[model samples]
Structures are given as C-alpha cells and as structure tokens.
Target: MENQKKVFIIYHSGYGHTKVQAEAVLSGANSVDGVDAELIDAKEAAGNLDRIDQADAIIFGSPTYMGTISAEFKSFMDASSSKWMEQSWKNKIAGGFTNSSSQSGDKTGTLQALSVFAAQHGMIWVGLDLPPGNNSSQGSEENLNRMGASLGAMAQSLADQGPEITPPDADQKTAHYYGARVAQAALRWAA
Candidate 1:
C-alpha cells in the first residue's frame, strides 16, 4: 500500500443518523484496495488542518439544519480559515453529503454550501454519478440514488426514527457509491 491515498470523512451528526451515512462512505472508500479512509467528527476535526492537508481527498457530511449545513459543521469550516488563507487545500479533491427529515428538506442548500466552501479552498469538487432511484414502479427501495442527488449524496431520515431505520438502505448505498467515486477521483489526482 505504498503511496496509498487517504480519504477523510469530516462530518457533524446531531442524532447519529448522519454518522451511519458517514460510516457507509468510509466503507466504500476502504473498498478501494489502496485507499485509506477515516471518519472524524466535526468537534474533533476543529483546528485540525494538518489531517485535511495530508489527505488526498476530503468528503464533508452534515445533517441539514434550517436548509443548510449544521452549525457544528459550519464551525469546522470557519476554523479552516487559516488553511484557506494558505491555500493549503487548493487543487485537492472534495465532495459532500447531507441528511434531513424530509426528502427535499432544503438538502440542496446544504450541498450547495459545501460546493461553495470547497470552491473557496480551490478544491476540485466530485459529484454523485448515479441516476435517480425509486423514481418508477420498476425502481426498488433497495436501489441507490433514490433522491436523484447529483452534487453529492442526499439522505432523508424521519425525525421520530433512529438511524437504524432511516436514511434507508438506498441512501446508504448512494453514500457508498459517492465515497468510492471520490476515492477514484483522488487516485487520479494523485497519479
């Protein structure tokens, strides 16, 4: 695994649902033979630009709150100002994921914010490449990309349900695919 690429999943999960999605992303990244992935909570990631700098790619995840990224994840983004000033993340690969109670839930705003954030750092953004799932009678709940997310993985979780039940298998699979896609992009960038 010499010269192996590292993918960091930096996120903030309020009710543990987003954590489940983060884990899926990690699993997908690790599935790539030489790619290493780790999940780091936003609280723990604060002021930790070194890890971000060293990683080949960084995938951001945050529970959508008020139609945008959660404040906790926003704090992490704010803390990276130094890195921004230094342009340390410039040209690095970046992607994002978000979860909410409703299917739409303004999830696009969160993803858009992530894209802008990545762009501010001069990072190349990677998007989910899958088509919409659960769109027709032929589409199964088990299919991936049910949300038709293109900017990144988007998940819906019932406010009353636990992570075990929501975000469904489909959303998790979408996250998995998104993660693998990012890893592949990182590999290409590294090469």
Candidate 2:
C-alpha cells in the first residue's frame, strides 16, 4: 500500500445532514483500492492537525447558513492560519461540499469560501467532474449532481426536516462521487 493515498474529511454539521454527506464521501473514498479516508469534525480537528498535515488530500464539508459556511466551519478555516503561514498544506488536493435548505440558498458562496480558503493554504482545488444531472426532460431526480454545482457538491435539505429526511439520495450520491474523484486525483498526484 505504499501507493495508497490518504484523504481527510474536515467538516461541521449543525443538524447532522452534513455529517451524513461526509459519511457518503468517506464511503466513496474508501471504495478506491488504495485510498484511505477519515472524517474529522471541525469542532474536534484541533487535536488532529497531524492527520491533516499527513493527508494527501482534504475534503471540506459544511452546512450553508446565511449564504456561507457555518460559523463552526469558518472557525476551523480561521484556525488553520499557522498551516497557511508555514505552507504545510501547499499543493495538497482540496475539494468541498455544502448543504442548504433551499436550492438557490447561495450555496455557491460557501463553496467559493471553501475554495478561497484552500487556495490561501496553497492547496490545489478539485472540482466535481460529473455532468449536471436532473437538468433535462430525460433526467431523473435520482441522478447525481442534480443541483448543477461545478465547484463542488451542492445539497438541499428541508428546513424542518431532520438529516434522515433530507439531502436526498441524489445529493449523497453526488458527494460520494466527489469524494471518489478527489481520492483518485490525490492518488495520481502522489504518483
């Protein structure tokens, strides 16, 4: 497994939906034969900086609130200042996913924020590679990337619903695909 790639998923979920999405991403990354993915909640990542520094790729996830990443996620990004200063994460693959209550809930803003944070850390950004799904008459709602996000996975969950009832299967599948894609990219980068 010398060629194996290690990916760390760092995220914060206010109501658990984002955690589910993170799990899907982890599952997808684990599907790759030489990829090992681990989930670290943003709230708890302070103790895991070593893992982050050792990772070949990092995938960030967050719930969109007020048109951007949740406060907890923002805090995590802010705390990475030391890494930024030292360029510890430089050139590592970076990707992200975000969830919101509405289809157009400015999820892009969150994605943009994540991308910018990654860029500032000198990480290479990875975009979702899947074509837009559920965009045509023949497309099914079950299709992946139905939200048409190019930068990362965008997921919609009902405001009143719990994680178990929202972010639908399609969104989770999109996240899974995104994780797999990032891991693959990380593997290639390592090679």
State which candidate has the highest lDDT: 1
Instruction: List candidate 1 segments past 4 Å from native.
Output: none
Task: Put down candidate 1 lDDT per residue, 112-140, tens digits, no spaces.
Answer: 99999999999999999898888998997
Per-residue accuracy of model 2 over 18-43 as CA lDDT, tens digit each: 88899999998899889989999997
Per-prediction backbone clash count: 0, 0
> Which residue pairs collide, candidate 1?
none
Least accurate stretch of 10 residues (summed lDDT) in model 2?
Answer: 43-52
TM-scores, all models, native as reference: 0.97, 0.96
State model 1's lDDT.
Answer: 0.92
- Cα TM-score of candidate 2: 0.96
Off by over 4 Å in 2: none
